[model samples]
Target: MARKTLRIAMNGVTGRMGYRQHLVRSLLAIREEGGLDLGGGDVLWPEPVLVGRREHALKEIADRHGLTEVSTDLDAVLADDSIDIYFDAQVTAAREQALKSAIAAGKDIYTEKPTATGLGAAVELAQAARAAGIKHGVVQDKIFLPGLLKLKRLIDGGFFGQILSVRGEFGYWVFEGDWQEAQRPSWNYREQDGGGITVDMFPHWEYVLHELFGRVRTVQAHVTTHIPRRWDEKGKAYEATADDAAYGIFELDGGVVAQINSSWATRVNRDELVEFHVDGTEGSAVAGLRNCRIQHRATTPKPVWNPDLPATESFRDQWQEVPDNADFANGFRAQWELFLRHVALDEPYHWDLAAGARGVQLAELGLKAAAEGRRLDVPELAL
Candidate 1:
């Protein structure tokens, strides 16, 4: 059986997430694995053409990855009739315009989250894609994480009976960039560049809580610019205007409450950089990026409250590690495969632009709730 080739125009392949996750780990990996088997003696092959402003960087990436196509001309690539999908992993502020152009050109779209810097722009993009009758998707990669998948399995298996509350602690101390270079991009510290913990992380939490538990109804948040100053890529001091940390309490449907703390100023004290503890009536589970530990009510230990005495019991030992009963693919790669199959086979994909718009709305409202010092209701997007 002959394999059908799907041409993909990938913009922002020069960036970190775009280069490492989307290009190398996902698309290229798919190609290396002899493309996706669509079954019934048919296969779908992905041929990605790197599109960016830097020809040198694009060429370098193409050469390094054994890719044959590299084009700096986005407009020309969009105009080409052969490209089936146009993917955008560009910066938040530039995403809307590029996506609009792609939609206008009658191309299916898949993009990284936030979708756009503002909710209005994100919704408008969603509406445009819908009006154009194009298949569109947003990267909600966290749902594909191994640990989260385990948590979902537990929830689905009725292990977590009568879900109550969720506590998420996500953060790590990013270097100040004075003595050491910052791990993240310097643009992440600038508000004008669409940088902030609320914008960056709330979208993630929004989908995570909504998909895992229920849609978020109300949000109360506190955002702070913990690190007022930071060094840039050039080792020059710059004022960090964006909020470095955000504390949020979300009220989900079904009376489930979720509290999430996201920060770049805090040090890691948890098992992973990000971890969520979900407590239910029957059991409790703590999930990080790759591992999950559960404590059933029957196995839960009882301890007398005594603050003065030295703690004797090993609290961490009470929980049992959840076994990896299933093979776990890379989170981003798994989502990429799903999206590819969706585009190729016309599979139902719920994580569309409108869903992404909801994520942006949550972030927008979270920032508002933080500024106003009050709980803000998350109204459903009309799209």
Candidate 2:
């Protein structure tokens, strides 16, 4: 019946994703709700110890949020015996060492992906966490998405019989930052900063594919920097050294082919910024972030290729929207809550650092496949 407060040393609160999703939406939201329910009158509360480079920004956020604990010194924060968890949403380059430090400090590790800039570093970090005997998790927020959840339901229920192929499109135009301000951080365009569509997104694809459908057996990709030049935040022109777009073909288990296109240079033409169309023998589904529509084989419309004339069929009307049967919470918060439960009670959490390493491995191979211009086997990672 006692309330337990978990002190989370959150690194990277100054950044957009770390600020919006992790800090404001997930952690603070959980705190405002009087903590996560641990059942039987027990509650698990989270107190964030904001950690970052900028003291002014950290102080501003803390003052704005009525938080007291703020520290720029990560080592000092980690050295504190009270800090129960270390959550990293920092830039990829900084993540590996920070996670290693956290592991050394014996704090529960939760982090944003790809866990590290490279597969070797990620696996080493994972191994360190495992050796330290600490709880660990990676942010795989897509799995908890309403649309993807529904798609998973369909898969589990055998709605998609003889699952064949998956087509995924994810992107939106990020302004080149010449005339207009870019939506994303400027570091996203620099290869030295660990910024690339393949590195940033392939881990996400790996988790999604591995969790919902199957493990990625093979990867073939074409990655390129569509926008060669871009202006930075200070309106200074710079070469966009990182890849902006990637076209990938992942061979999943059971011979399911998944082709996904991820780009920051492309304009949005689809219903959502991201969508996946899965076709099976029994049915087909088109899923966005929040909505999923399905077309059964029974109701499959037969149409002839009539490019010579105006199309008569309303092809979009054929599929029915999958109703939201349950109220869905914010994906990030849902995962965070599960992570809390996992930390508190040692619940079954599959999205560990090793899984994160696998994601990094997949992405690394994806980039390699792109460079080689050949399909590369995604070997089973052991860490």
What are the lDDT scores of the predictions, listed in order? 0.93, 0.94
For model 2, residues 1-383, the per-residue Cα lDDT tens digits are 87999999999999999999999999999999989999999999999999999999999999999999899999999999999999999999899899999999999999999899988899899888888999999999999999999999999999989999999999999999998999998888899998988999999999999998899999999999999999998999999999999999999999999999999988898899999999999999999899999999999989999789998878898889999999999999999999999999888998999999998998899989988899999989777
Weakest ten-residue segment in model 1 by summed lDDT: 89-98
* Clash list (residue pairs), candidate 1: none
Q: Write the per-residue lDDT of candidate 1 for residues 1-383, one digit (tens) a residue.
A: 87999999999999999999999999888889898999898888999999999999999999998899989888999999999999999888788889999999999999998899999999999999999999999999998999999999999999989999999999999998999889999888899998998999999998999899999999999999999999998999999999999999999999999999999999888889999999999999999999999999999888999999999989999999999999999999998888888998998899999989999999999999988999999998898
TM-score of each: 0.99, 0.99
In model 1, where do residues sit more than 4 Å from their true spots?
none
Model 2: per-residue Cα lDDT at residue 3? 97
